[model samples]
Every structure is written in structure tokens, then in C-alpha cells.
Target: MNLMFVHDVRSETYNEETFARSYGYKIWEERYLPVFNKINVCFRNKDTNVDLNGISDKSSGPKVFFDKRIGMFKGPDVFFSRRIKNILRENIRNNDAVIVRLDSFLGLQTISECRKINKPYMIELVGCAWDSFWNHGFLGKILAPYLFLKTKIEVKRAPFVVYVTREFLQKRYPTKGISTNISNVKISKQKESDLNGRIEKISRLGNKIILGTAANVDVKYKGQKFVIEALGRLKKQGYTQFEYQILGPGDQRYLLDMARKFGVENQIKLLGSYPHEKVFEWMRNELDVYIQPSLQEGLPRAVIEAMSLGVPCIGSDVAGIPELLDKKWVFSRKKDKANEISKLLKKISKEELKVQAIRNFKTAEEYDYNFLLDKRFKILEKYKDFIRREK
Candidate 1:
């Protein structure tokens, strides 16, 4: 078998690469390559191009191509281009199976071409892009119809669809057949010896580390502002020992200014962005509690990683988060900052926190790479037969 995984979206590669580090991408590339014999990944370098310098090991088994000039034409006009259609038609001709990661108009376009060419193709839905745009007030009300029409057409035409969450399926296409989110790899348990140095570094800072949230500050929907406000309230109530760390890239000057306005500047630390591995290390040893205040998400890897490390998480009650927690562990008043922060503080305890952390680690076992990969391969096997019958 020959498999080609097409990623039209560029931004996800950065975080995906970091998350896959615990489970080597080369190992994953090898597993899929031999199962199919030949595997190719077609993607576009929209922003910063991916450096293929160290990817040479798996480069031969699974060829990766980054087209620099693709997606030059923005908006709906992109779908009508002959150049994109021709390029996709050529790629689909040689590969026995193609997996299209949802992020670009090309994924839907390729699905249409695959249907015409009698090629086996699968659609992977990370989330509804339109929903994200709408939630942020980025997409105008005038464009709602256009977005809805496009989504409906794509869902109806695609042979198979993979959703990251049940919420995604219910909101986007209720009747569509759904496959659970599949992780290409997994993270191994970090040994205590490996974290000793980091633990010492954090211990040097003092004993009172309270809460931490890691994400790009510029993304308003991530809800760092809400956490900041919550922390300010906690400080006003005489919770002086706690420190809140916001880690990621983007302008933190305004956030810092906001902290000053709230008189909690001393308690808030804007760590900016660090290397992914370093951040993961910090999450394991430096942080006391992990919180993801995002207003929306599609099975965020940060929360999953924290859970895997036995870090108890307090996330906004939205999307797939409750599913991840199995409705057992969650911040009840997540929409109300002050109440949520109060609840979090009340829940923290030496013995109770440790017990909850163990539960968090145990919950993450179901999402392990081996388990998800097995589920995915089984789906693909059945899907292959389904497509054959259709042919």
C-alpha cells in the first residue's frame, strides 16, 4: 500500500512536532511507511517554512513536500483555481490512500477530485474553522451562508470523516459518520531522575507556586485574560503565596499593564515562549497546577500532555474538555473567574492534590499513542474494504 498524508495547514506542524517528540516521528514514519511501502506528505509552507535538515532519516521512507507558492489566492476564489486542481489530481494518481487534514480549502477540493478519480480519501476534522472565526468575531455575518454551504458540501461529498471531539460532530455535521481523534504518536513517562535538575531549579524559586497556563498570548480565545483577572481577585483576598505563570509568544505588555492596573503585577509572571521541550519539562517539575482557560478547543494537546505527566488540570468547561475529564474533575464555575479561582484554591491540598494528579495520569492512558494508533489502523482497514466495495 502507498499512503499520502496531505496537510494544507502550516501552523499546526509546529506544535504537532513538539507534541510528537516524546514518541519519535521517525519511528511513526517508519511504522506507516513499511505498512504501505511508500508514504508521502504534501503540505504548503504558508508562514515559516519547515527546515527538513534533520528529517532526512524518515525523509526517504515517507517523502515530505512543502509547496511555497500554494494558497496565494485567498478567500473563496481559491477553490476555482485550475493550478490547485491539477496539482492535487497528479498527487492522487500515484497514492493508493490519502488522508487530508482539515485546515485548508484544498482538503475539500482534493476530496472532490478523489471522488471523481475513484481514489480512497479520508477527511480529518480538527474543528470547524468557521466556528473559530465566528467566535472571535473574525468572520462577518454576511459570510455565514458561504461558510455553511462549503461545510455542508464537503461533509456530504467526503467518503469518511474524522472528528477530534463529539461536540465537533454535533455542531458541524450531526448525521456524519464519525471517527475519534487519532494521535500519530505518544509521550513516555518522564523518569524522576530526568526531572531532578528542573525540580531543583523550581524549588530554588520558593515553595509557593500556584497555577500556570501555557499558550500564545495573542490568541484572545485562549482566555489568559480571564485567568489573570481571576488571579488578581485571589490576591485581593489576601492569597499572597500564589504565583501565576503565563507562558507563550505574543505581546504581553498589555497583559502586564492589565496586571498593574489590577495591582497583581507582582504575582503574575509572563514567561513568553520557550522551546517546546523546555516548556514540557517546566510543566512536569516547575508548575503546581495546570489550567487551560480557552473558550474553545478541539482536544488541545497541552491539556493532554499535562494530564499525561500527572498534573491536575482546571480547564474551561467547553468543547471536548468535559469528555477528557469524564465529567469527574473540572472547575464548575469556569465561566466566572472569581468563583472559579476560589474553587481551585479550595480544592488544592497536599494529599488530595496528589490523589487527583494520579487520577489525571490514569485518564491519559486511554489517549496513549499505541492505543490511538491501533484504533486508527483498524478504522483504515475497514475503510479500505468499504471503498473497495464502492469501486
Candidate 2:
């Protein structure tokens, strides 16, 4: 059967020859290719600068196809034109099934078009629109409640819903329709010796402790700032053996400036984004602890990946973070996350780190690739069955 997947995710094209996504392109083939014979993705075009160098990991081999005409239109930041709406109408009319991701301008608009023609579609609820917008800054604070309500109403009426977060997004945006909680994290089993290596690393972590987080520094809600602030608090209390490594794409000037103000400038290392293999290698070799200090999240893939590596992790209490970690390992979601992080980092012992590593690796077993694949396969099978009956 054919599928038309709708999302507002940004993607770039190479002269309409090859395509790439900010999220890896392999995700398409991995998730949809099993049940869907042919998949046509309808997503917003990436209008910003399309750098050619080192784009292979993203553009490697995307099996999904796209409509070049749809790619020509402006993205969600701009107004949706009538011509685009007409194109989407025709696109939906041709496909057997439509899966629209929620909490995006284009996705909501597509839902409107689907409903107008009495078309049946499914929803993918990944994150809370409320936390996303409220933490985005001034104008976002004003629009947060509106978008949150809009998303809630949309999810409430959808015929089928898939939530990435097990509990967080499910509670925030519920549905009376058929729904399932499935996280997007995929991890591989670690060797038993990997835990021994973590314990060995902690034994040697006497004077210096290496900490790291992977996220775009440009997005404030990722909570990179809080880590720096927590380090600052540690410094003020005469603790200065911590080093922070950041890995992701974004302007680091803000974080750098904050690092300097916090008097931990020398401790900060902004290692730009690397391929998945390289990232895992870095975590295994260099990191003493992994931190996901995000103010919001959807069961962050990074944390689970870290867990798979036997790296002790700390995350904010919001969303699915607490679900991944124990209460003591997580800081509160309030404004003083830095304080809570500071206290946790200060009091957490090496023995506790060793214990966390062992426990975390065990927890990660549930997200093993084969296990998740079987789970998602069943979900997609249900989706296909439901769509065929409705259409």
C-alpha cells in the first residue's frame, strides 16, 4: 500500500536530485519501509543555506520519495499559500494512508484539508507544544497556550495516535481514538565489559570529572545554560574539577559567554556534531557522565544512547526524562534546575555512579533495536489495517 507521511520537519534537496533531513534519513527506511510498499513524504523545505560538504550521513540513501512541487513552497515559518493547500489536497487524494505529525503549522493545515474531504489519518505526538513554546522566549510565551490547546484538540479527534513519550506527551495531549506509546530511541546491547570500563573510569576520576551533553546550543530550552550555571555554582562552593563537552550544531557564542561569566570558560569544549558512530565512540572513550539538562523533551534519544553505553546520566524532571532516570538522578523542572544539578553533581559519589552505570545499561535493554523494531512493526501493521478499512 502507498503512504503519504506529513510533517513540518525541515529537509534540503540537492538540485532536486538528492534529499536530506536534519534527523537522519535512514529513519524513513527503518520505520516505514516494512509495511509501506511506497512512501511519499510531504515536509517543509529547508530554505536556509544548504551546505554540501559532509552531508553524506544525512543524504546517504533515502528510500522515500518527495514531490518536487511540494518542496518548492516556503516552510511553516511563512504563510501557507492557496496553491500549496490545493497541492496537498491532491496529494492526500492519491495516497491510501496519511500520517500527520502534530504540533506544527503545516501538519495542522494538512489535518484541516484531510477533515474537509472526510479523509482518515493518523497522528504522531512527539513532544508537548506547551513546554516547547513557553520556553522559546517572549512571543512564544504568548502563543504557548494557544498552540497547546490547538494541538490538544487535534489529537483528541484523531482516529489513530502514536506518542513518542510513554507518559508525558500522552497525558498532555490525549486522544479518545486508538493510541499507543512508543519511544523513538533505538539502542544496541553493550558488552558486559563496557560496565567494567565505566567502573574503572570512575575509580580514576579523582581530580577531574568529564561531563558532556549533545544538543544544539542555539536552543535555550535544551538547558546547556543550566549545566554551565551548575558548574558555576560548583565553582563558587570550591569545587572546580568538572569539564564539559558539548556536541551539536549551533552558535556557541551564547554558551561561551555564559561559561565565561560563570568562570568555567576553560572547562567548556564545543565539539561540533559528529556522525552517530563517532558520537558513540566519543562517549565511550571520553565521557565520565552524560547530562540531558533539557527544560523539555520527548524521551531524548541521547540519554537512552548514553544509557546503552553504561554512562551515568542526569536529566531534568520534565517530560519523559524522569521516566528514564531515578528521582535522585533527576533535578526538578522549576527555574532553579542549576541549583538542583549543582547539588546532585556535588553529592553523587563514584560508587553511586558505578551503580547508575550498571542500572542504566540494564534499563536500556528494553530499547534494543530488535525489540523496538518488533514493537513498531505491530504498530504500523495496525495503522495499515485501520487505514485500509477506513479508506
Candidate 3:
């Protein structure tokens, strides 16, 4: 059976094989390929530059439908054109089952088309479009309302709904369907066991904690500024043993400028983007405290990765963050994140950190790929009849 995956995640090339080698391998291996014999991914044309340093050049992966005209905002010309809609309709008609990654402009259109044709499709609620309103630019602010409403309707109409954050997305977009909470983080049992040893090592390390987070610095909603300010507050209060290390691809000028403004420039280091293996290595060996103070989130994978490495985490009390962290480890994103975080930094002891790290390691084990793959396999078992139906 062929699976139709509708999303706007663009890759560099249009060649099916090259595209899969670069971007589609993981989804194919972990999510779609296990269930479907073949997958037909409908995605937008290449638009932005992505880091290609670590992507493997392998031949095994998914079928691609690189829609040249479909994208986030294709201007007035593409919006009124029937060709994009026709292309989506054609793609949807050829597949046995549909999986729409919601909140994308093209994906919503495909889901709407699926509804019109009465094709059974599952909705993967990964991120919320409505929560991103304040972060958008002038034109994006204008388009956000339409996208939010479109996503809301599409989710409810979907026969199956899987959310990265169970409580967060469910509350915002309620659906009466076969629903399940499935996170995308995929650690292994061996790695979890290794992390227990790492926690023991961390407990032996001295003071001068390294607080770190991984996120694109360009996005304002990530609350990078808040983390910096919290560090500044900690420094001002005579606590000078910690440093903030951020990893990810983005312009660091804003964060640098904020660090300078707060007079905590020396305490912050922007490590930039690293490969997944390197990131895990760094988290395990280098980082002492993991921080996820995002103003909003859909269950951050970075925080979970840090936890899996036996690093104690402090995250903002929003979305799925609270679900992963204990109440004491959680700080308010709006009200007193800086104060709460600074307070926690001062009060948290080494023994407490070790205990919390072990607790977190246990929590992160549930999201391991081995477990999630089985969970997903069982979930898809009920939909086998729908997935295997002929066109």
C-alpha cells in the first residue's frame, strides 16, 4: 500500500533518490516505511538553505512529489491558480492512506481535498499555528489567522490524530477520533543504560554549571532573550560560576547583543549547529544544566535528549514542557521565568540534581524509538484495513 504524506517541509533537490538520502531517510525508517509498502511525499519546492554537513548520502528512502508551485506563501498568483489544487488532488487520489502534518499551507489543502474525496487520513499535530502568531512578521501575522482556522477544521475532520504533546495540542484542537500521544524523540535502551553511568559521572563533577539549550536563535518565541536575562540576573546576584551554551543554526547577533546589553556577554557562548551524534556527546560530557525556557513549545526534543543524557533540565511552564519536567523544575514563561529560574539555580543542590537526572532518565526512556515503534505498530494495526485498501 502507498502512503500519501502531505507537508511543506522542503528539501534541496527534486530528485526522489537524492531527496530521500538528504531528508527523508529518518521518517522512512522510523515512521512510514514500517507501515506502508511505499510512501508518496508531497512537499514544497526548495526555498531556504539548510545545514547539509551531517546528512548521509544513502540510496534507500521514500517517493517524492516535489510540488514546484506549492509552498508557504506563493503570492496571489499561485493562491488563485487551480493547478496547485489539481496537483494535490491527483496525488491524494493515487495513494491508499493519507497522513497530513498539520499547520502547513499545502498540507491543509491536501487534507481538505482528502475530505472532499472521502479518503481516510490521519493528522499529525506536531506544532500549533495559532501559538506562532506573535512571532510572525507583518505578512505572516495577516496569514496566521487563516492558517489557524484551517488547521483547527482539518484536525477535527481527520479520522486519526497523533500529537507530539498530548495535553497541549488536545486542549487547543480537540478531536473526537482515535487519538494517541506520540513524541518523535527516539533514544534506545542501551543509550538509556549508558546515561545512568553518565549521571553518576555528573554527580562527581564540581560546581560552575553549564546551562545549555538547543534552538534557532532567529525565532523570538523561543525565549532565548529570557534565558540570557536569567543568566544576567544570576550573575548580578554574585553567582558567577555558570555559562550559557546554545546550539543550533541561526543568527547569533540578537542573542549576542542581548548578552552585551545585560552585561553577561562573557557568560554566554553560541556553539551553533552540530550533528546529532556530536550534540548527544556534548550534552553528555559538557553540559551540566539543560534549560528550555521557550515562551511556547510542542514538546522540545532537545530537552528530552539532554534528559536522556542524565542532565537535569529546567524548562518553561508551557505546552508539553511541564509534562516532562517536575513542577519545581518548571518556571513561568510569562510571569516570572527569569526570577524563578534564578531562584532554582541558587537553591538546587548537587545531590538533588543527580536524583532529578535519574528521574528524568526514566521519563525519557518511554519515548525511545524501540518503544515508540512498537506503540505505533499497534496503533496502525487497527488502521491496516484502511491503509491496505486499493484505490
Candidate 4:
């Protein structure tokens, strides 16, 4: 059986010969390949102005393909082009199932066509559509409420739904269909998470405190901006004992400008995005604190992994973030997140940091890669059974 996976995550071409993805297709292939004979990863291409310089993955085998032969313009532009319509239509008609990663424009279009053609379909809700659009700057602000409602309506009618968050997304976009919650994060048993070493890092806090997060520098919603603002706030309060680092790929010009305004430009470092395998090593050896300052999120895998590595962490309390954090560590509002993050920095102590390190590692223990993969497979198996019956 062939599975069609439709999501709005845009793709970029580095050399024009192949497409690269920041999030990569390898993770999706790993999840779906076991359940189907083949999987078609149908994603959008980037807009003309924005580019992230993405890395490529060598995941395609005899069983799967990146079928972008479905021409460009994945929007109302589809109405103007016959070529775009036919390729998309054939992919839908030939595939045994369509998995729409919801609340995205491309996913909406894919689902609309699936319903019209009476094809078997399923939903995988990853994050809040409302937050995604609302935090997405000007164009997104205007579309936020409308998109949120549109996504909510479709989710309610979906026949099978999988949520990355257990509570937050379900409350916002409830589905009447058979449903399950399985986070996309996958940490493994073989990897070492040094809780004792983390305790020692906190012990060495007599020196400068190093705070780090993983997010693209240019993306405002990733919430690194607030961390910069908070760093500035701390500087004003005469706490120069701090260094902030971001590990993700993007143009850092805006961030540098923001840091300069706060007079803390020298304290911030931008480490370009690293391969997933190498980043954990960085996290384990380098970080004193891991902060997920996202304006919105599903269960953030970075925070969970930081926890697994016994890194003391804090985040803006949005989406599934609160589910993973203690109430005391979470900041409730975006407008006040800078102030909130500043407050947490002010009060951080050796005892509290060690306690959190131990606590977070214990909680993150449940997310080992093999354990979550089994849960994901169970729901997919149920979905495959549904597809067989539909035929």
C-alpha cells in the first residue's frame, strides 16, 4: 500500500538538483515506512524571498519518493493551472490513504480534494493553528482566527486523528473521531543523559551562566527574540554573568540588531544549525540551561531532549509546553515572557537547578525512541485497517 503524506512544511533547493528540508523527510519515512509499502512525501516549495539553506536527506528507496512532480503553486493558484491539479489528483487517487498534517494551507487543499474524491483520509494534529498564524507576523495575524476556525471544523469531522499533544491541541481542535496522542519526539535508550554531570555544571555556576536554545534565528515565533530581550533586562539589573547561544540556521541580522539595542550583543552567539546526531553532544557538554522560549508549540521535542540530558530548562507556557514543565517554571503570556524569563534567571540557584535536572530527566525517560515508535505504530496499524475496510 502507498501512503500520501501531506504537510505545509516548505522545501528548499540548495543546488537545484535536489530538495533539502530543515526538519527532513527521514523522520517521516522512518515512521510510515513500516506501515506501508511506499510513502509519498508531498510538501510545499518555499516562497521566492525566504530561504533557510536546508540540508538534504538520502531517504528514498524502492518504497518511497518525494513526488513534487505535482507542479508548484499549492494554493488558490491551483484553480488557474491544470497541470497542478492533475498530478495532485492522481497522487490522491492512486494512494491507499492520505495523511494530512493539519492546520496548514496545503493540508487544507489536500483534504478538500480527498473529500471530493471519496478517498480515505486521516489527520495528524501537531500544534495549534491559531497560535501558528497569530504569531506568524502581519499576514498571519489577519488570517489567524479564520484559519483556526477552519482547522477546528475539519478536525471535528476527521475519521481518525493523531495528536502530538495530549491536552492542548485536543482542547483547541477537538475531534469526534477515534483519536490518540503520540508525540513526534524520539529519544533513545542507548544515548547517555548525564544527570550527574549536569549537577556539576550547576555546581560550577560561580562562573558565567550559559543559556541555550535550538531555533532558527529569523523565525520570530521560535521565541529566541524574547530571550535576547530578557538578556538585555538582566544586563540592566547588573547581572553580566550570562551568555546566550542559539543553535539553528537562519539570518541572525535581526537578532544581532536586537541584541545591540540592549547593549548585550557581545554576550550572544549564533551557532549555525547542526546535524541532529552532533547537537545532543553539544547539549550534554556545553549548556548550563536550556530555554525553549517558543511563543507556541506542541510538546516541544527540544525541551524534552534537554530534560533527557538533565539540562535545567524553562519555556513560555503555551500549547503542550506546560504539560512538560512545572507550573512555577512556565510563563503564561507572550507579552510578558521576557519579564518572566528574566525572573526565572534571577531566582535560579544551585539547589533548584539540580532538582529540576533530576526531575526533568525522569520525565523525559518515557520518551525513548523505541517506546514512542511502538505507540505510533499501533495507531497507524489501526488507520491502515480503516483504509482496507474503506476499499
Candidate 5:
């Protein structure tokens, strides 16, 4: 069937080119691309400066333009552009199914247009957008209620909502709509030789890599500052061998200041984003532990990738993390941050670490290509019947 996959946010599609080069865009290119006969993905291309040619079966449309100087007023432009694109695409395909990954301003427009046109569309709630904005202090307190209301209205209009995290399912997913929890997709196994080479390079940089977390450092909700603080505490306890690597790009100056303020600048490595393949290779080969300290998340793709490589993860017991990981690996959501870090570190004896790694790998296998693909395809297939019944 023809499928129009709308990626309203460009950052979601090509923000990290370096990482994508090394590992390839396996999540979308491999996992979701084959399900449909044809697919069109729309995304922003300006900031990412990425060529979407090889990433998907079809090219991504132009970036949504907005007046940065005007700020809030820029919303309508995006909303209309997205709606126009969906309407045009829907007309071209006649009676194709559409899936909108609503992480952009255009999503609201697309949803509205779909309703007006009586199109069969599904919304993918990758995460709680409202919470993500509020946690980062981006969506001001004054506007939060309005944003929540807007989201609630849009979500309710969709016939099907796919949530990546259980937190989203419990807190925000509409009870009246048909909702499904489908966690992040995983990459298939790569060559062991490649994985080893990547690991060696990362290990050669330090003796004991205590913790690692990767994200656009500028996004405050990622909780990068908390990880830095935890690193400082580890150092005070004489864990000098430990090092933390912050991957991805965005506001390096701010991150540097944070590291210096924590007095752990020397222990933190700011690896500006690498190609996707190399990033995955490095994760598979070099990283000893993966930590997701995000204040909020839907289901982080990075965490799932790390687990697939047998890297034990220590993430905040928030959102969908607890659903993905075992109870033991999760740190208390309300515990003292430093104490939680200490507790996780204390559990990693060499033997226990190996066992945990294996367990993580096994858990990750459940989200592998075959498993996720089957589930997703089944959902798509069911959509055909649901649409007919709706008519």
C-alpha cells in the first residue's frame, strides 16, 4: 500500500548525520521502509544540512520556514505548510494510508486537514511533547495549559495513537482512542569484527569509562547536567579512572560551562557527533555503560541500540524506561540523584556487569527488526479493515 510518512520535525530525520553514516538509518530505512509499497517522508533540511537521498526510499521535502525573530507567531506558517503538503500528497495517492509522526508544528495542520478531508490517518506519539517542552522550560508556564489542551484535542481526533513509552500510555494517551505501545525499533546484528574495532578505539581513550550518554546537549530536558553532577560525585569518592562522554551537537559552549561548573571538565569528553554508523560502531565496541538521565522521554532509540550491543543501561525510572528495562536496572524516580548514581555504579562488579550486559542484550533482542516489523505490519494491515469499517 502507498504510505505517506510525515516527519514534521527535520531534527528527528537528520539531526545527526555523523552517527547515521556509520550505522546507517536502520530504524526507519530498514525497519519501516519495507512495510509499504511506497512511502514519502517530509522533514526540515536546513539545520541538519543532511542529504536525505540515501536515508529513505523517498526524498524528504524542504524544511518548514519560520520567522525566528517573531517566535510564537511562526506557528501558523508551519501548520499551514504541513496541511498543504498532506492534502496535496493525499490527492496524488487517491486512497493511500497516511501516518503522521507529530513532533512538529505542521502536525496540527495535518491532523486538521485529514479530518476535513475524511482521510484515514494515524498519529505516532513518540513521546509526550507537552512534558518535553515544559520540563525544559521552553513552553512557558503561562502557555503550558494551552499547549496541553491543544495536544489533547489533536490526539483525540486521531483514530489510532501509537505510543513509544508506557508513561505516555498512562499519562497522556487518550483512553477513548485505540492506543498501542510499540517501543523503539532495533538494528540487526552487524559484523563482530567491526564492533570490536569500534570498541577498541573508545577503550584506548580511557581505562575505565564509568558512564556515557548521548544527545543534543543544548536540549536541557536530556538531563546532561545531572549526569555531570553524578560524575563529580564519583570522582570525589576516588573513582578517578571513570570518564563520561557526551555525544551529539548543540550549544557546546553551554555544555562546556556546565562541565566546568561541575568541576568534572577533565573527566568529560565532548565527542561532537560522528557519522551514524561510526556512532553505532563506537557504541557497540567502546562504551561500557549507557545512561539515560532524561527528565522525560518517549522511548529513546539510543538506549535500545546500546542494549542491542550488550551494553548495560542505567536510566532514570521515568516514562517508558522502566517498561523497557528490568526493575533492578532502573534508578528510583524520586531518589537523591547522586545516591542513585552511586547505587548503580556499586552494582557493576565485573561478573555482575557481564551478566547484566547479557541480560540487556537479551532484552534488546525482543525489539529487533523481525519482532517490531511484524507488529507494525500487523497494525498497518489492521488499519485497512478499521478504515473500511469507519466508512
Candidate 6:
């Protein structure tokens, strides 16, 4: 059967080649392509000027619908455009099944169209748009309630649901029909092996701990500010041996400025983006502590990856973090997380850290792609059976 996936992540251009090269394609190739006879993706195309050079020029397997213009939320021109409506209507009619990545306007419209046409569809609740609204700024606060309410209603309509985080998202977006927890992150055998050696080294580390976190600095909600504050507090307390590393791609001006203000500039380093392989190498070999102080998350992949490498993790007690971290490692986001995190740093013993690292590795094993695939396959099978019975 033909499968259609709808999301709001804008692409540079609309071409089969670019679609094939995108991260979305990798996900579809791994998870859905095997099950469906053919796969199609519908998303916004940002090539408003029609730059042919910007468009991908290679061959691709899955069909793509990049008819929608970018900036749906910026104004009404694209939001109320007939082009988007026709695109969704046409895709819904052509596809045998639809999977809407929820909380985005595009996903909402696609699911609504699917319902109108009596099409079978499911929801992939990857992130909380409401929580995002709360964290990002004034705009997010304004849109959070509407998106949250809309998603709650749309979720009930979906015949099946796939939640990225088992506990966090499931609690917020409850579904009436079949549902399963399938995380998006996966680790390979090589990665596991790389982690094994690094685990022993980190397990034997001394008083000089190396703390690290990987996240885009552009995401204000990541709580890098809190981390820098915690480091400053630690420094003031004479805990000066540890070093902090922040990874991922983005302008570091804000973070750098904040670090300097806190007088912990020398304590932290902003390491830019690296290949996944390199990231794992550093997580496995170079880091002692992993911090994910995000104000919100939907089962953070970076935290899980660090845990999979046998690195002890500390994060905000929000979303799926508690499911991964013990209470001692989690701090309240609303409170002075800096003070709480500093206490954990000062109080946690080396032996305790080692034990936690071992425990983390075990927890991460449960999220391995192979394990998640089995659960996902079962859900898909159930959906297929449900569809067959309907006929």
C-alpha cells in the first residue's frame, strides 16, 4: 500500500534527490519503506525564488509533495493559501495510508483532510509543540494553547499512535486506539563496542571530571544558561578541576557572552558540530558527565546516546528525562537548577558515578533500534489487521 508522511519541517527545495538526501528520507527508509509498497513525503518547500541550483538533482525512490510554501506561521498568505489545501487534498486522495507528525499546522491539516476522505492514518507525536511554545518566547506562549488543544483532539481521531517517549508524551497526548512507544534514536554494534572501552575509562576517572552536552545553541530552551550558571557556582565553591563542553552547530555568541558574565568562561568550551561517528567517539572516550538541562524534551537523543556510551547523565526533571535519570541526577527546571546541579556535582562519589554509568548503559540498551523495531512492527501489524477487518 502507498504510505504518505506529512510534517512541517521545511526543506531548501522540492526535488526527489533532496528528499532522498534528507534526514527524513533516512527515517522513512529505515522504518516505513520496508512495510509499504511505496512511500511519499509531504512538506513545505522554502525555494520561493525557484533556484534550480538549490534543488536536488539526483534520483530518489519515494514520491515528494513540496507544494506548500514556507512560513505558514509567519502570516496568512501561506496559511490560507489554496495551494496548500489542494496539495493536502490531492495527497490524501492518492495515498493508501497517511502518517501525520503531529503538533504542526501541516500535520493537523493533513490529518483533517484524511478524516474528511475516510483515509486511514496514525500520529507520530515526536515533540510537544505546547512545551516548545512555553520555552521559545512570546510567540510560543501565544500559540501553545491552540496547538496543544488541536493536537489533543487530533490524537483521539488517529486510529494508531507512535510516541517517541514512552512516559512523557504518552501522559500529555493520550490516545483512544492502539499506541506504542518507539524512540527515534538507535545505536549500532560498532557504537556499542566503542562505548564499552570508554565506559571502563570513565568508570575509573578521578576528581577531575569532564562534563559535556550536545545541543544547538540556537534553541534557547536547551537551558545552556542554567548550565553556565551552575558552573559558575561550582567555580565559586572552589570546584575548579572540571571542564564543560557544549557541542552542536549554532551561533555561540549568547552562550559565550553568558559564560563570560558568569566568570566561568575558561571552564566551558563550545565545540561545534562533528560527524555522528566523531560525536560518539567524544561521548565514549572524552566525557565524564553528560548534562541535558533542557527545559523540555521528548526523549532527548543526545542524553540517550551519552547514556548508551556508559556516561552518567544529569538533566531537568521534565518530559522523558526522569524515565532515564534517577531523581538524584534530575533537578527542577522551575527552581534554581544551577544550585541543585552544583550539589549533585559536589556530592556524587566516583563509585556512585560508575554505578550510574553502568545502569545508564543498561537503560540505553532497551532503546536500541532493533528492540524498538520489534515493538513498531507489532504496532504496524495490528494496524494492518485492523484495516483488513474494516473491509
Each model's lDDT comes to 0.63, 0.80, 0.74, 0.79, 0.64, 0.75
TM-score of each candidate structure, all chains considered together: 0.75, 0.91, 0.86, 0.91, 0.78, 0.86
Candidate 3 off by > 4 Å: 14-24, 45-51, 55-83, 135-146, 190-193, 387-391
lDDT: the better of candidates 1 and 5: 5
Order of candidate numbers by TM-score, starting with the best: 2, 4, 3, 6, 5, 1
Identify the candidate with maximal lDDT.
2
Poorly placed runs, candidate 2 (over 4 Å): 15-22, 47-56, 59-62, 67-80
Clashes of each: 0, 0, 0, 1, 15, 0
- Give the C-alpha lDDT of model 3: 0.74
TM-score of 2: 0.91
Q: What does the lDDT come to for candidate 6?
A: 0.75
For all predictions, the C-alpha RMSD in Å is 5.3, 2.5, 3.4, 2.9, 5.6, 4.0
Task: For model 5, give the RMSD to the true fold.
Answer: 5.6
- Structure candidate 1, residue pairs in collision: none
Report model 3's TM-score to 2 decimal places. 0.86
Q: What alpha-carbon RMSD in Å does predicted model 3 have with respect to the real structure?
A: 3.4
> What stretches of model 4 exceed 4 Å from their correct place?
13-26, 46-62, 70-85, 190-193
Sort all candidates by lDDT, best to worst: 2, 4, 6, 3, 5, 1
Total residue pair clashes for candidate 5: 15
- Which residues of candidate 1, in runs, are more than 4 Å off? 11-31, 37-62, 71-77, 80-86, 116-118, 140-149, 166-172, 175-185, 189-207, 249-263, 272-276, 326-334, 337-339, 384-391
- Across residues 219-300, which tens digit of lDDT does each residue of candidate 5 receive? 7778877778777777788766667888876678887887888788998888876645566766765578888888777788
lDDT of 1 at 26: 58
